[model samples]
Target: MAEVHGCNIPEDRYYWIEKHVWAKPEGDVVLVGLTDVAQSLAGKIIVVNLKSAGKTLARGKSGGTLESGKWVGSIPTPVAGEVIEVNGAVKANPGLVNEDPYGEGWLLKVKPSNWDEDAKALVTGETGVASYREKLEQDGIHCQK
Candidate 1:
């Protein structure tokens, strides 16, 4: 993991930095979640709405929406895929997104319909960290807590 302005960017996961989302491929499904920077920017998440399992999403489509004291925005899918599952824990306690944005706060599991094509739009490893760092610096964004 690389920390940029207090925001964590895990090297192992692919990131859609512009969308503030991360995707970690696990076998046939990919785990999706908001990045730490996103949670920090949103400020104390209050609600999480995710698309139901079996729903198909195009790349860049909103898988759902999130509401917080400071922000309200859609959670975009980084890859075109069918939603396999949603994290019940996040729905029940939206604060978990602020508490653990990359872990227990994960929003969904999706079986990608076009990984190779979609992956071209994402960044990972050192490239991702560098890109995210640049964006954070450019936007003057930093994670709190």
Candidate 2:
């Protein structure tokens, strides 16, 4: 795991630093979730509204919305794809995002329309960790416990 301003940015995932989102590929589908930085910035998540399965989302578009004490905003997807799955657990208990943003709190799974083209734009591995650190500094984001 990589720590950026005290927020965890796991090296295993691909990240879109500006969007505060992460993607973990599993075969044809990619699991998507908000980063710890995002969860921290939002405060305790109160709700997560994901686009329904089978819906096609264009790259850089809103895949859903997340609400918290501090704010409510769209969760933009990094790549265009079909929503293959949406975590129902998040709908019933949004706090799951606060508890485990990368695991059980994952937002959705998408079958990317153009995986090779789109994923090339994401940051991953050691480079991604470095990017996360830079993003935190650029945004003046300090993780709040």
Candidate 3:
């Protein structure tokens, strides 16, 4: 497991270092979601509005908005492409973000037009874990651990 600022970063994820998002390869398309660190920083999510299907989104662009209590923020898409799917489960159960973020709590499914190009921008495995730690230290966020 990866940890940053005392936040959990499961090593299984493919992280978008810049956008603060992550993706899991699920067949031809990918299952996208916010990393645990992101959710913890964003607080308790209340509502989410995802880019509809067939909607075109730019790489690293905000594909949807995340509302957490009084905080409102965007979840940038890691890949440049159209939104093939959105998680209705999250829409109905916004708390799922706090429940099982890496699993059913995922946000979008992007059909990356340039996986080879964009995937390189994201960090994974040990490298990703290290990066998240560095980012937290830079931000003066100490791990809860």
Candidate 4:
């Protein structure tokens, strides 16, 4: 894990910095989740509504909706894909996102339409971590660690 402004960002996942989402390849599908920074910014998540399995989403489109404290926003997918599975646990206990944004708090599983093409839009590894740190600083955003 990499720490940027006190938020834990696992290098194993690819990030859509502007969207505040992460994607991890898992065989034919990819797991999607909120970043720790996103969870922290949203405060305590209270509700999550995910798109059903089989729903096709365009890159940068809303894949789900999350409500936390006074904040309610969409969780966008970094790539175009079909939702393979929705994380039921999040719907039942949105607080899990705040507790563990990258683990049990994952949003859904998606079978990408063009992973190779879309993945180019994301940043990963050390460069990604550094980019996120810079973006957070520019936005004056601080992780609530």
Model 2 ranges off by over 4 Å: none
lDDT of 2 by residue, 39-122 (tens): 999999998999999999987899999899989999999878999999999999999998899999999999998988888999
Which digits, one per residue and each the tens of the lDDT, describe model 4 over residues 15-114? Answer: 9999899998989998999999999999989999999999999999999899988799899998789999999998999999999999999999999999
Scored by Cα lDDT, where does model 3 land?
0.81
The number of the candidate with the highest lDDT is: 1
Task: Give lDDT for model 1.
Answer: 0.93
lDDT of 1 by residue, 37-56 (tens): 98998999999999999999
The lowest-lDDT stretch of 10 consecutive residues in candidate 4 is 4-13
TM-score of 3: 0.91
- Sliding window of 10 residues with minimal summed lDDT for model 3: 136-145
lDDT of 3 at 130: 91
Scored against the true structure, residue 3 in model 3 reaches a CA lDDT of 55
User: How does candidate 2 score on lDDT?
Assistant: 0.91
- Candidate 2 vs 3: which has more lDDT: 2
Candidate lDDT values, in order: 0.93, 0.91, 0.81, 0.92
Cα deviation of 97, candidate 3, in Å: 1.0
For residues 7-96, write the lDDT of model 3, one tens digit per residue.
788887889865668987777887789877677767788998899999988877888998997679888888888789999989998988
